[model samples]
Target: MADFAWSLGSPSLRLGVTGLSRAGKTVFITALIHNLTHGGRLPMFEPWRAGRLLGADIRPQLHPDVPTFDYRGHVRKLTDARVWPDSTRQISELRLTIAYESATFLGRSLGRGKLDLDIVDYPGEWLLDLPLLSKDYRAFSSETLERGREPRRTAIAADWLAHTSGVDPLGPADDEAAGRLHELFAAYLGAARGGSLALSMVPPGRFLMPGDLAGSPALTFAPLDLPESGEAPRDSLWALMESRFEAYKDVVVRPFFRTHFARLDRQVVLVDVLAALNGGREALVDLEMALGEILGCFRPGRSSWLGQVLTRRIDRILFAATKADHLHHASHDRLELILRRLTDRAIARASFSGAEVDVKALAAVRATREATVRRNGESLPCILGVPQEGELLDDHLYDGKEEIALFPGDLPDNPQALFRPPEAGEPGFDALRFLRFRPPPLEVTAEGVSLSLPHIRLDRALDFLIGDRLA
Candidate 1:
């Protein structure tokens, strides 16, 4: 019914853009639309390369309730101020109308084809909440508690764990107690996501990123130590927590699944694979589990023209490892392979459901340009760019304006090596550095026209994502 209503209003292909925190969802959408609108170089995009892609324009979507993607403001910040756009916090929409000459002879005879591309930007953290639908409060609490007890999480989750240990599920309902537990639990989640530790299994995902539901009772509940094979008394704290958990799944997760996720014709899940690598084997394994849950939420399947008209199914899934600029071009393929390895199971699941799934390593906005420097009388591949202020590496702190060339470590050829425990003498993730870089300065033409944001493999990604639709 939802898809029918959506299709009745607009004949557009909806693309879901989502990623884990700091995976560059905002930049990808901004750069993609900017390149198409400004005619930025897109050789790998078939329609753009063949001169069949005429032009593109952003159109206001029919839904007034959905906030429009702030394309212009983001462009102003990137081009005029030379800074990255703020990360997305809430859901937003943008529709790009592309006028293109059709590739087929018969298609050309019919005249120019215009494809309305509806881009839906949402936080991947929300997608992490999907599994909550099937999980009861007891199960959810059990899983979250088990994760908190893990060795890696022991320190970060100490306060929450200690506090939760004292809370009884069958105790009298106390709003203050629930709120306190929520605070410590949320703190543990936030700390786990910090730079030094990149754990990803923090679910009730909205707890960490509570956009509008911050202090509401819907967000106040926390895990409690429950007795085995027990029932909660009607007026007990467990009952309140369970009711709120159900309310969260009802009020938050289900609506998103029905209204937005279920309507997507395609999806690209961006992963900050480098950060996961930095956190070592446990983080990598956690990421894999999170991805499995994420992949399972998607309704991926092959649809005939008639089938598509009747129901919306995501027919293509792109799992992109974002921030390719952090590594040199020499390791891009290795990076892609590593992501491919990480998501191999999820890809199989999607493929079995009849969706075309592919993976790539991409930097939506290329922050660094490549260079070669001689060190110890040997040429070494390095990337030249400005590191953000206060970023410390090798005992040198960047002032955010000074540009420097760096040999941002290479990804290993064997993707499996990343998952295995390091050998005594093995130069592992500890040996590498992944520093954040500011957005590159835009290229200006002689006439003072600014070109589109530079990128790596973005064109190819677009080609695989929407090329067939344009054709």
Candidate 2:
């Protein structure tokens, strides 16, 4: 056992998890906790493979005021009900005490290695709010409006764009006017997020997740058409929107940042790249833009002893392409390549900050198995799993009970090919099929011990994110 005096003084690394809605934040956390505590197969995680990792156990909440993550409840749903856990609706916390053996003789002389891992889960939709701190209302409005004018967004942003184009920023401020304009803008944001469009650049994030501030005036402001060089008249429409916008930054975003986000030592941004691909190239571009902006907000760098005393900076950031089990094993590398290329720019910026950055394709929990099927005269690689009911693919709608094999199309080996437009009749990404899969039943050993959740490259994710700390 480690001595409490010295061991307790060791700093705990808080890992923040966030991404777009349905990007699997909740599921990822659930799997992380489940795997660590249960001794899941993790050959790539050095501490585990070296036989230095002992075990992990849930600990008391570090912040008692925050709601605790429902790890047990989520496990029951995945193991018993055979379904995916729900997405993150609000900020939640989980703390783990990781016990291990020291790799170094000096560390062994002191005591065994142990660490407190504080995990923070929050809605990714609201993540873009962090950047609002540096942006003035005019800059925000300009950027937002410019994006709305893009070819793909033009139709979805029609009503709000038309209304804002006519708004007189110098007009007298009226509560009713503000409410109406904001309603239209919020509708456009809703439409942008709805169904298959799946655009990720939707900001004024509070508009999407307004918890208690749903109808408050602070949330009732929308971007307006204003001149670039002059200020609007005092107490004008622009003034109202600007004040509320600032209030959003000060009253809402800042507290969350100071309390939770700024304190993180590591972060994992889960991306449902497959969903974005299914939405089309426009969605992919928007996803890239959103990810880049979100990454820009992270104060990433090496966390030295002095730096730790002065301020906290995320020293490591992992960008994971989730739902890897949807494709055959042969296509895993291609998917990872596509993700790295997709976020290549963001990865470059983060890396320049002196932080270790990497991208991996993972499924947290594997819900499918690979198989080879003979079609006509050739052998085709496919994945077998139970599709969610009513899911239509290749003209067959699944009934949610029967297992089926799907031939996921191949991805370009050349990552650059994704950035370029395809020929008129050419199809690669657009031809692939990605289907939703139910959680697979756990396999039991002869002694009745159920195996830990199966996954694709999740061990690599663990190795990259926190393996060094364990060492």
Candidate 3:
């Protein structure tokens, strides 16, 4: 049965990744695939040398029904900016075919098989709807209302909270009061989404696209609200609230999961814990709650017993805190702490539920270096980083401070906390101050290119997802 199950007709791995908008999925996938194709330098795995013909040739997927991604094109655009244009909107899917040769147990070579890897990219907006799967109006409204109190979101919350106060929490959900709240919620999302108005996943383009919607509506929403006024009980309001919550789950939540979530081989969940830390206690609480709820979708805790017994587990889950390039090298530890705290709830869920999870605080791209400058008798940490687009100050003169050697702990949510700059500069303040990510130089030798740690990380992640079949 095990051999039969591992046959070519069966999928060796099914990894799923979920992250908020601007979380760096495209780059991670692109780099992982790029390194896989050129695995000479990678640890433990033999590269696909030209003459050796390891038997695995990455071809465009031959699935007649599913769409194939231009993996090479995206890679070129990411590596060579002069080629394909940058991606601006959410692409439907990026699928690739990875075929390779692995040693067989019988001391004889096994037939070459294909690995169909699919990565579906969608908006983060839809992710916010998952909690609704198990929530009612009062629960949803109150939560959204409470979340509105954050300093960054106070401006938007003022309008919806005021309107919610007039409605009877117990009144029918579709009552005039309920209707007003619904519209306000939608409007708030629209404003948060640059008036996309549709309650789907807000894509990364909204944040990094450079078009409109940069500092948009903040995508703020209240969880269910309790009756603020001591009015008579109105049960209809509860009914209305429940119905809308259901509508949100069915219309928005289910489709994304069915289409995108269910098709992966490995998964990564990105959290912006630094922003939450900067936002303070309320933001932290909200971040924790959001992380918990989002992780619930992938855990076996909610799976049916049959699913737990039969379906493949989401073997490797990488909870990465993105935008690591924002901070200097010294404070990477504190960033890890902040991230661990923020994700403790989800980590607990995965741990108790039997899923293998790795929490990493990475910048996906190393943006800046910790350099030093000596002023007077004291030395301070300064950033010697270049920007992604803009030109950096061109000066080779050193002020004694060289980039500090920082071995980042696991990736963190609050990258800023882990930042220990050699010297303070006004420019490198937040996530916005990141240097463009450059791939580590390929180590070449007499044989071919060699593998590095990043390449190993990808290999292990892949192995966990489907090593048995690949081997």
Question: Judged by TM-score, which candidate is best?
Answer: 1
Model 2, span 1-471: residue lDDT tens? 112353367558789998888899988999888889888999999999999999999987667578889999999999999988877877888888899888888887878888899899987777788566668999988988887888877888899999988888888888888899999999999889767898888887878877566888878999887886888678999888899898887777766766777678899999998888888877788888899877766743335222333247678889899999998888789888888887888867655455777889999999999999999989999999999888888798888899998898877677676667886766756688888988999989999999888877888998998888887
The lDDT ranking, best first, is: 1, 2, 3
Off by over 4 Å in 2: 1-10, 165-172, 227-230, 299-310, 349-353, 424-426
Q: What order do you get sorting by TM-score, best first? A: 1, 2, 3
Pitting candidate 1 against candidate 2, the one with the higher TM-score is 1
- Cα lDDT for residue 460, candidate 3: 38
Q: On TM-score, who's better, 1 or 3?
A: 1
CA shift of 299, model 3, Å: 2.0
Residue-wise C-alpha lDDT for candidate 3, range 1-471, written one tens digit per residue: 012222366244544444655456655556556665654333433323222224333444433444444566776664545222243244344445567554554522555656666555454445555555556555555566665565656566578767766665565544556555655765564554331111122221123232232322222222445655443244666555555455545544555555556545466776665554444444456566666756665663446432343344565666776655556555555565666666776777656456666665655444355566676876755555333333232333323223332222223334444343424532333322222333333345678745421332344344444455554
Q: Which residue pairs come into collision in candidate 1?
A: none
RMSD of 1: 3.1
Please tell me which predicted candidate would have the highest lDDT against the true structure: 1
Expressed as tens digits, the lDDT of each residue in 203-266 for candidate 1 is: 8888877777789999889888888987889889999999998999878777777677777899
The parts of candidate 1 lying over 4 Å away from their true place are 1-10, 299-310, 349-351
Return whichever of 2 and 3 wins on lDDT: 2
